[model samples]
Target chain A: MLKFNPRNYLKVTNGAVLLRAEIEKKMDEVSKKEFKNLFLIGSGGSIAIMYPFEYIWNSTSSIPAYAEIASEFMLQSHKQFDENSVVILSSLSGTTEETVEAAQYCKERGATTIGLVGEMDTPLANIVDYPIANYAENDYAADSINLQMYMIIFRLMHNNGEFAQYEQFVSELEKMPENLISVKEQTEEKAKEFADKYKDEDYHMLIGSGTAWGRTYAYSMCVLEEMQWIRTKSVHAAEFFHGTIELVERDTSIILLKGEDATRPLAERVERFAEKYTDKLTIFDTQDYTLDGISPEFRQYFPPLVLGSLLQRVSVHLENKRNHSLDKRRYYRTVAY
Target chain B: MLKFNPRNYLKVTNGAVLLRAEIEKKMDEVSKKEFKNLFLIGSGGSIAIMYPFEYIWNSTSSIPAYAEIASEFMLQSHKQFDENSVVILSSLSGTTEETVEAAQYCKERGATTIGLVGEMDTPLANIVDYPIANYAENDYAADSINLQMYMIIFRLMHNNGEFAQYEQFVSELEKMPENLISVKEQTEEKAKEFADKYKDEDYHMLIGSGTAWGRTYAYSMCVLEEMQWIRTKSVHAAEFFHGTIELVERDTSIILLKGEDATRPLAERVERFAEKYTDKLTIFDTQDYTLDGISPEFRQYFPPLVLGSLLQRVSVHLENKRNHSLDKRRYYRTVAY
Candidate 1:
């Protein structure tokens, strides 16, 4: 609760939900057009946000979806990408050099582009065919961008007749602002306890599987390393048994983000192994919290969202306890590289 | 050159090149059959080896290529995977649990599976439709497996009219055993110097781009973490600037795996930043080694293979200087989870 702003959180979340009409119109328009595949392109957190949707599309839709890093995507001639491809891009600042360049690249290739940005009338928003603008500070950008992505991605799938429960899912998504507040309230104590315990910890191995893998990666890189300056390794749970398991010891901190997806068993295997090997195992399972409006079947798709809100609490506590400003940076924007 | 066996290395590398005819026969047969997409599936180092090939396919061929983690691949219901798909799997041991299971899963789904294994009659080799077996010891497994993959993948692409230089490439492949010996001879001192300097270092950040990314990840996880019990963060060169750049101090060991590809600029960007930020930066560039029999046009495709041969030298030197056995593992197969 260090920087919690209930009014702003509601404004951002509800603002995304309110975009249901506009997002739907765009989805309908794109769905009506002929496209071969979906290219979800971005940089850093924006690219990480696309991974889950790519997974979902791969698992559920006949349409091929690729989550590509923007900088590399431009240079690497993806044989599957063409004029018939629909690309989705995001950047909170609307001026992430690579994302903007990627959008321009796609536009030049006659590909349809959609961009999500924090502010309008900027490079990224202006370059894309369809631009969705939502205002949120750095702390809540994930929540805002993720909510908008859920609408854009699922609506597209629904329009394609791949996801039938679109209306029902939106109805439930409307309750997330309130439900997420409860999730934060429930997780605050655990978050505080984890921060107090691990404030001085230098390294951690964060693991997750399936859709949860993206959050695990983004948190380790973007949040922990970038924001908190913590050294962390984010490995998929299924891949943990391969090489990373050798690095585990009794004191090695293992943070597991467990989700209720089909790949849950993979994470469970890591849980079993870590429970036996490391005494400092901490799990943030979405199943631990009760959402008032979310149904059991629908919960599988909500882990990333639930964990996004929950991890924000952990980040705030870490910032408060470690006496490190979350916004402080040594080189990100301070000096010329 | 510690533990370097020229005869065995030649035996393994040439043995794989000799499989060119059999590999082509199998690829021709598979190409005659209709397939929609290509799935290169494995776990850890096995999976890491597929990334560069996936990049190759995306850059050069008209097929949609996905390199997936085997354990999670089996759990996630991938809509793009079906009877009409072709799957390429590899396991140096031929008994990697998740890979064998994935082959079985693919076989049950009626997909065409081609497996590359170290030995014949193993679970993975036995389960796939086409099993290409080559003899290789633990140290030379990457060399053997990579050589075989080049044959199988390029042959398939050639059969599909995607690659016109298959025969020319094969002629160049025949000289790799001798050429790689030279690569090792040239890298010996540099690798030894790296080992001598970093023997006591606890952590490093490995960066790479394009075809070198897979080797970067594998060297960090499989060699350093699993084998030497050292800690490392392997990040793509493009992603390095996004988050990991902040962790750079004057003494941070930055291992840059520079390759000749379009994404070379991305790695060069990291090189520039690391040069400015960290004094302990070590770059292993493929351009430094003159491969005698390889043509300039074919150099881009050889980085992963070149890096594989070069990194083995680094691994051997580290094993000696650090007084740590490269075969040592705390939990990989030492005990049950």
Candidate 2:
């Protein structure tokens, strides 16, 4: 477990889990209001994190949800966004220019705004109507934000009468901090092996579907390209056959983030194809890990959290094996654009 | 212009324009009916083509529009898609398996389904409630599909009382074929230069925003990766700063698709950054072309069409300069997955 701190991870994740009461109260208030639609806005990893919730909300609830990039959302002048709309935005630093500006934009439009941040009293937190803060480092922020999102979003769905199993789901979620630690422990060895094996691989294709798609996208752009400086293409399983599948060669690295959702079959299709075409196919299926005290029915909702925790292990190993600082950046925040 | 076919382009684009009367008749019926939302469903390039319309719809109309991948849409069982949903699908060959299945899925749910195809009696055309066919070759397919999309989508917005200048817009659209020809003619030399310059580049970063985003994604994946076996990372200009920008270096090839839209500033920001960071920066701005008979006020809506026509020239030059056939594929339709 290179650079891994289990105790700190638990502390950050527990902090997020402990926000359940406050998140519940805020979600209850917003859910009681009549909103036409929900806009989930953020930048980069933040926006990628919202994709799973958007997919979940669209599939399970009558309320429509849109996951939009903060800058694009600000400029689009979306006709669907109005006073009756609810906007949820996140920025771990709470100082991300685009997210903060988007929060201000939503406030000006008289929409209900919720902010998720790693610290309190930041620009984003100050502008949002409901600001939920938790302390977490970069390695554990995904687990923290995702944990809080599960509490807020599912509660909203419960209030909408779309999810009757909320109590059971949250009960299972409460056990995740401990279970996710075990997931990291189990994945550590494999992550190390993967990093050791593919440290110098120039390009890779990461494919996923359903809830896992966000993790696939974020891990490629935010981690592989941005963190490790490795080239990668993150394509949805359904989109693989369309164009990207043609890029597959015998030695091409293909990483499949498989989760237990309705779209699992789509990922399986890609796995079948990749197995035939490439020798460097890697499948990170959440089904291989057993979360103690979690129901099988709830596994569908656990991919984002589970995959996040597992990938954190992979990130640490990649940094160790590649001898590249995960925090190193060539231009981002280094120079003014 | 290399590989240019003016007569065939006019015939295909005019066919789409001719469909306006029938498209209006069908859209009038759908608009008169009570509908909850619009679902723009397709696979790969089909879904990519729907993105601009989705953006336009969200910006101009109160009606919420979703652009969903066909296979994932079927599996997700999106709650936003119901009997009151107007589902639009396209499959050029009218035989994309996922798209046909999606049309069936929507039909079984009693949703209004519209299919745009190259043939009238194919599976997708036969299954959809309203099928609009306009024969086109690969080079002109984008033009044909985008032309019909402008007509149908704008008419839908007009019916929703969101577009007051639909007549003038359509009139301008009628002049697009000839104007688009001029765009190709003007861009021919630059396209050839770009192809000759970057024909051997292993990878490229294609950045675009707003209406040009879809073209960026499609060109990178569908043309570069699939057709030329050249790796590419197509990122939205807004999202470029988030993660992908870190990958840009002095010799890194960056293609900027600049379109006139609310998000034009986002592209400009990327342009400024790439100018300073990379010497291999190529800009294909629709503003460079004088679209005769098109009002300045209407130029914003023409980027997708204009970019599509302009890129067709790039495709022809790339094929010629690289000595690679655009239709040749290693996997796509060449082998069974």
Candidate 3:
């Protein structure tokens, strides 16, 4: 039997912080004129690494940025490159064929390639101009490293001319490493309560609207399906009214990520939806922060990048509710083509 | 009392032929330019319209082309545009916020904009330099116009320059409109079978992979949810093997869009999946095709586009199966939005 480590959240959160700091330290050395675009490439959990960074980028500098499934960037037509473009290639295993190929393609196209990896030495690290190494001593699939790398990039941009005005946001982000751990620890009782109450259900639905849309979409549909062997789907709250609410029954479970801004109207609607199915709705919201301050800019978006760590924690506890373990790699083959 | 006239597949086939001819005529004029990249933008069904064109472009030409959801495109940075680019904007309404915004953005960035629309009088038609209008005399939403416009575009590209090699393919497409009609007549039985067999089930899953992936993803996940008031989820067949198959049970309903080509292996897997449930599977294959020489270039990709019409047929039939007359509109609501 696996022993439950009480510090799971702290370890993961700290790892993310250190990872971010290390990446930013190195990025401080690179000249601003070197690259224009930052292509954050990954898939599955590896892709989640860039979400916070993407938010930071969109919030601070209008510097063009995009994230693609590594395979898509490599296989699709991506001629939008100059020597001045920076390609941040991330893969926890330092393998992920698509990310590897994307890194190679960027280098071939004369773009500056930056490697974010869990291992000190790998094909990805060897190919890129700069490699940020994370030993990934923890078995959390390098989420910490991914988070750290994104933070580093974000902080570097913020500290530099790109996002000088956004220094406060970076500082706020800096505070999250500790807050995330605290939140995860504090939320365990609530999560356990949620899992115990609704664990027997066969299906899970996650709903969100704006910015949180991608995260909820990724977590409920992709991550839960990939990690927990859960049959899950997500929808925009407004869209939920369009049709999906009919699928809600007393036995069905709905996880609503209300975040900050766009919560009230959707919350009221979901309250009615929950009443119809009585005792089937679960909401994850940042308690202390109102819609105004916590997510001042894209407040209507989901907040899991900061608070979603709690969901990640709750998901692990809810594994017993699933048909398999939390880390079931059934869908992924060891030998990637 | 409403009098029912049997749909003449032959006339429908002829209309498909005319639509293809018109789109092809336009493609002949457009393909002369040397473009390094092509981006097709649309939302919902309009994005579905680009399926066949992307298939033809991928198979016949060396140039890179792709169709992306307009909403996703809007979130990304677009400082990487100048000339030698082609952007095809598709939206029947001409006012889909995302598409309209993208059209304006693409135009501002110097990418040539071509509008494919149902209404010649709409803003999208007036905004673009070259607009191909497929006016739907009666229909409000994009039912016939979408298919007609795509067929025209594919045929024109097929006839242009080095594309002449696929002339036989174009001829087969010319015959597809008739095939679509015939298939619709045939699906009357299958749709009834689907409705009777699976209507009581609480969930529905639509599975496809590769080129067909997007269509199945959009239709079962997006359209069926919008139209049928059903709980449907779309899964890439490969991903199904990853973890989704565990959700299957004796009562579960699965719709497999088995397009021609590499889909067979996955289809066979799904067949076994259906058998495990003792016959709860409804599979749609290329028997829906009327034309034989429908170019096997991107065989894995093209079949789903062909199935677009087939899905519509099934949807209507499923309504009859449920003893519900299809409601075209909600009270006092305009379809224009």
- Writing each residue's lDDT as its tens digit, candidate 1 over A155-174 gives 98898888999999988988
Candidate 2 per-residue lDDT, tens place, A1-337, comes to 6687889989999899988889888999998787889999988899889999999999898988999999998899999899999999988989988889999999999999999999988999999999999999988888999999999889999999999999888888889999999999999999999999999998989999999999999999999999988988888899888888888899999999999999999999999999899999998999999999999998999999999989988998889888999999998778878
Q: Mind giving the per-residue lDDT tens digits that candidate 3 earns over A1-337?
A: 1223537645655655655555665676554555555677766455655654554454445455666555544544454445767777776667867678878888888887888777767989988888876555434544465456545665556655765534465455556556555666667788778777766665788876433554566676555666665678776564465445555667678887765543335545665666556467777766444332333553333264545556766776677545457656632463221
Descending-DockQ candidate ranking: 2, 1, 3
> Clashes in model 2: which pairs?
none
Q: How badly does each model clash, as a count of residue pairs?
A: 0, 0, 12
Fnat of the models, one by one?
0.81, 0.84, 0.11
- Candidate 1 reaches a DockQ of 0.84
Which consecutive 10 residues in model 3 chain B have the weakest lDDT in total? B328-337
Root-mean-square deviation of Cα positions for candidate 1 versus the true structure, in angstroms: 1.0
Candidate 3: docking tier? incorrect
TM-score of chain A of each: 0.98, 0.99, 0.79
Model 3 chain A scores worst on lDDT over the 10 consecutive residues at: A291-300
What does the TM-score come to for chain B in model 3? 0.82
- C-alpha lDDT of all candidate models, in order: 0.90, 0.91, 0.60
